[model samples]
Target chain A: MKSNSSTVKTRPTPWDALVFAAVAALAVLTALVFYGPKARTNAPLTCVVSVGGEVMDHVPLASFAGEHTYSHNGYTLTVRVSGGQVEVLHSDCPGQDCVHSGPISRAGQSLVCLPAQVVIHLESGTDGPDVIVG
Target chain B: MKFSVKKLALCAVLAALALGLSTLENLFPVSLIVPLPGVKLGLANIVTVFALYELGAPEALAILVTRCLLGGLFSGTATALLFSLLGGLCAMGVMILLKRSRRLSVYGVSVGGAAAHNAGQILAAMITLGNTMVVGYLPFLLAVALITGTLTGFVVSLLLRATAHLHLTNQSDYR
Candidate 1:
């Protein structure tokens, strides 16, 4: 402690509301983009599971069956893949967000487990570009 | 940006405090309670804000950088450090600009910083995961940051008030 006296004359201002409102609006717009509909396509969907930033599996949703257990960072996830849908039936991760996410069937939807650094998402099974320039 | 003995000592303390706060926050089952991925309340920001206001930009930046490095090591992975460092820098940048503008209260600055922090983390996640599905989690993270940031701001103000008598610095270099 300096014990010299005086300082911290600054106080919180009313602009706090403005900043909160702006961030709130931005969050809503982004959430819409996240869960919003995507362009319809006939390409088969693939369930992609990535761990530690490595692609562990890219199984075609319809063809895949049964549960696969992945262990990472001392946590394990039992992922159930069937009926063209992917779900985390159980996980040892503390958050259990992947399990709570239920299941994802649509392309671009993901179930993330941060503790395990696992990502499960749906994408076009083809892995081909829609358009190629030049 | 010469570091006086007092300033250096204070910066060290603040950096340690920030690291401690963040580690303490991790002890809570916040992720389990919130069910949101990569959502941290960023409690360490209290120390950052304190340094930014009481000390100057340079000192605050030093503390932040040190905390990130140490935090990364403590987290047991490079990726955790990457996200934490990026988020911390972005949050500190926003808070610095907002504080300089003097147009917003401490709460506004904290909220803005929190928002920036969330954005930065999501950006890191997107790049590392090689996909955009994580982007959908943005709004949820920011929404939560709004509430948490406001409270962080309020706490900073209280901290400033309580420490007003400590005389950390006789000169104000905040701006």
Candidate 2:
């Protein structure tokens, strides 16, 4: 005698297909919008550093060739400028996200350290956008 | 059709379980691991999945709302509460619609719900921050949602299989 049991099916369904398509579309759209190429210029670049929403220092990327430390509100961020690029070398923030954000040399690029309330942006001669979507 | 004392009691228990899971998940230093501000394992979603299947949509929504409120009050900030409320409502809505359709397995419905949850939170963040830059995080958040949702759905499926004869829901009346 065979015992009866309800078996749960594990096959893919139409709904699964729809979800895959939707997620795929969203991924593609986000990549296009955020990772797409921006207008590049040869204008002189400067790194603008702000702490707690107040501008603290502005150093030209070309002039700064070593590490610069910014401390505020019991937090410290080590920013390194090398080869015309600026990057967060280290941060005391628990998440360390700013340090992992890599380097930025392009105009309009920014690295924000939320824990320390630090915002570093590379600006060019051209006026930046009124509002950067990302 | 009628609310039974047993159903109410079960819902209350489930809500408590969900709140416990929510609080427990908060103890982990997830931000350090994920490097995202609001990302988490969302372990409480397990209870939401179980409620959706064992009780019904309305019951599941009740559990979701109650858990979010209590969890917020217990170990979260006002902004966290706002995000969780928005995300929970959107996720519950998606899961209910998908479950009603009966075309998707629990896994698919769970994934859809999780993705919708992230979308809702992203929308909330965009509104609060007054910048579309928040939208940049959507892709990463959705990817994480898919993974965590699948895990939660798998757990729910196992529970459903093990308790098939418990008659968690009045199938004839509700489903």
Q: Please report the candidate that would top lDDT against the real structure.
A: 1
lDDT per residue (tens digit) for residues B1-175 in model 2 = 4667788888999999998888888788577888778887888988998888777778888899998888788765887888889999999988888776656777888888888888889988977876665676788888788788888878887887777777765455543
**Over the stretch B1-175, how does candidate 1's per-residue lDDT look in tens digits?**
6687878898999999999999998898578878776667788988998788878678889999999999999889999998988888999898888877656777888899999998889878877887665666788889989988988888988887788777786454432
Sort candidate 1 into its docking category: acceptable
What fraction of the reference interface contacts is present in each model, in order? 0.68, 0.27
Question: Candidate 1, A43: how far from true, in Å?
Answer: 7.3
For model 1, the superposed segments whose C-alpha errors exceed 4 Å read A1-12, A37-44, A47-103, A110-121, A125-134, B172-175
Task: Give the alpha carbon lDDT tens digit for every residue of A90-122 in model 2.
Answer: 998898889888998766679999989999998
Interface RMSD, one decimal, each candidate: 4.1, 5.2
Q: Judged by TM-score, which candidate is best?
A: 2
| Each candidate structure's count of clashing pairs | 1, 2
In model 2, the runs with Cα more than 4 Å from the true position are A1-17, A38-47, A51-53, A57-85, A88-100, A105-118, A122-134, B172-175
| Cα shift from native, residue B27, model 1 (Å) | 2.4
Question: Which 10-residue window of candidate 1 chain A scores lowest in summed lDDT?
Answer: A1-10
